[model samples]
Target: MDKLRTVSDTKRNFYQYHNRPINSIYRRVVEELMVEMHLLSVNVDFRSDPIYYLGVCQSFTQFMNGYTPESDKDSIFRALCQSIDNNPDEYRGKAETMLNFASQKSPQELINWLLSPTDDNGLQDVANHWRYALENPKFKYSRLFAIGLYSFLAKSDAEIVKNEEKFAELITPLTDKLSLPIDKFKKDLELYRSNIEKMTQMLTVLADTLEASKKKRQNN
Candidate 1:
């Protein structure tokens, strides 16, 4: 805790002269803190909430040397989503930044963010509403309804969702399998977890390919 505070304070002091030398001592401080966070994993279950999402937005903005465009809110939003999907621990420090400059994200954005980390089982907190909005979608946030539901379904139980449009053909039979009701959420979390794992694998493969290409080019 003291280390984090020391880094935070160091950044504050460095901000005064950082423009003159531009070494950005604070950047190193923040990165060290991020490493500490990776080791800690303090907030293991950060229940996909508005505050958490907004915090991620703030963290990116702050790390970019303290300038965020008014017009590029969507870009910032997407980056935040991607970062959270990448590292949940780094997101804890994000809360401070988010509290200052971030806006509350749309429900659909929230849902999609959760769904995109499909392989990370930590994100299943929002599953109950996945199909509810897909079928009904009455409110202003309805625009998010379909996309969120589809993302969730694709990562969870694609078969049920693929045929969900045929409410009679699919949802009816599913209503019996779980023995609860057709609409009640089934715990097919493996779908989301597998998706996240797949993404991690793909990223690893791409990174390896890029590194190999760089080495070959250097050798040439």
Candidate 2:
């Protein structure tokens, strides 16, 4: 059997591809993702599903948006997955596939599909597995999975997700159905969104500082 990669191994692989140190501000985001992915990869019940992949892809894209040496972004992403014995392309492709599928459905239709036990559609298998995991006491729940669930709802109906009351209404039924921890899931997503906003502001400030420094050097 192939040995599982450690967090240190994954970090080494990530840096190897980038060929430069990650910016201090963004290093936490990258390392957190690496650790999360590594933990999920090692968990027996944490299956690599489209929803989870969507979470991983979204988090990586949003957090690493302003990385320096823009050219190294793809390499960094590839190394992240490779280090964990996963494929970056698969993660991106699956995330896109899930989003596309969700986008084409109405909010009600998406909910129905998730609740349906019949395997009539492509999403049914994913739903089935999700339900199984929800019921399994041994299944590991992570922030990434919560983000995936949030992404699914956002993709299905942007307006509903934006409206606080509507969003809760939409989530309540699904959480009740799956016996999920509604409070924890919502809290994690809330924190995720808040952190994203903070990161965006920090990136803007960093960019402004760099631009000012560059102009100062040019004027010298």
Candidate 3:
């Protein structure tokens, strides 16, 4: 059996990889991500894939957009993956591959791929695994997985995802077909979108404030 990872181990690995203490403000983010990844990693039924990695990468990038000492962002990300004994590069590379695959297909094509198996290769193999997981009652579902599905939909049809009515129309039937918890999936995606908007607004305000301060200093 694999030894369970603890928060302390994550922190230690983070510090070691970063070569310094993480900022107090950002520490919570790291801890939360560490805990989530740890739980998913340990779950016997949980399978890590490109879609989930995309979710992790997207969430980390968006949430840490304005992290101070910007260079530390890469170090912190690397540390987070290394702490879990996973490769950050694999996450990034696979996610990019998934994104590229999604970009080439229509929303319906993507949905059809998920609903029915295709010839096994590349994205088709991923789709096959997703179909199997959805059918398995023991599959461990997480917010990260929900985000991954959302990301794929968004990539397949940006306009549909942008509109609430259209998005619901698209996801409702599919969720039902897969026996997923529709309410919970919708709720998590709603929260994710809301948090992202709030973060963007806050970043905008901070940028404006800094610009004003810089101008004031220049005028002095």
Candidate 4:
């Protein structure tokens, strides 16, 4: 296959694999992240609270830093431990226990569990959660929450490139079309892309912070 065909095929295959649910029904990570943001909206004004939003970004990046396709049960558990360790004030008590339990699973399994709804409540799935979060009157700032969640996911994608093993795993598959001599160029490009992604994430946060602050001032 040509390079373009290879890229398309790879994406299609991976999407089919990653998007497939271990459970009978499929639940997307993006939807789950939005639901999580809605829950967070109860405590922080993603639209108005600059500091809280920055904290959200920090938390998102930290969590994503620990997670990747290459992540194992132990690494994920350690990441959860570190998060709880660093933010005892936020992640303590019953919440901490639940998170600790959740961390033992692989990333896919963990996501599946997160996207799964309670059996007793019949809460539906991740899509239902996202819809409820957006439509519920209690989540007045849900639009903002969703926007923040999208940013969090984007940042997480960029953060994953920082993982050398994960990055190599990601790029190695694309090498079928290239000559051996171009390997150095591919490596260079990987490093370049990683740096650019990180810088772009930083700029996005700064830009979003400024825009949010401007809107808040105007509303005041």
* Winning candidate number (lDDT): 3
For model 1, what is the alpha-carbon lDDT of residue 149?
A: 35
lDDT of 2 at 18: 61
Ranking of models by TM-score: 3, 2, 1, 4
Q: Which stretches of candidate 2 lie over 4 Å from their true place?
A: 1-5, 13-19, 117-138
Query: What range of 10 consecutive residues in model 2 has the weakest lDDT sum?
Result: 116-125
Tens digits of per-residue lDDT for model 4 on 111-161? 343334232222243334333433333333332322232232233365544
lDDT of 2 by residue, 66-162 (tens): 7877887788788788878788987887688678878887776767665653455465655565566656655566788778877877888877877
TM-score of each: 0.25, 0.83, 0.85, 0.22
What is candidate 1's lDDT per residue for 1-220, written digit by digit as tens? 3343343443344343222322243345244434332322223322333232332333334333322233443333333233223433333433333222212433234335433423233333323332332333221221112222333333334454555354234333323332322232333323433543564565568679989999999999
Error of 3 at 78 (Å): 1.4
Clashes by residue pair, model 4? none
List candidate 1 segments past 4 Å from native.
1-74, 78-184
Off by over 4 Å in 3: 23-25, 117-137, 172-174
Give the Å shift of residue 54 in candidate 2: 0.3
TM-score quality measure for candidate 3: 0.85
51-142 per-residue lDDT for model 3 (tens digits)? 68888888888788898889889888888888878999988876776677778888777777666647545666556555666566665668
Candidate 2 residue 180 Cα shift, in angstroms, is 2.1
In candidate 2 the C-alpha lDDT for residue 119 amounts to 53
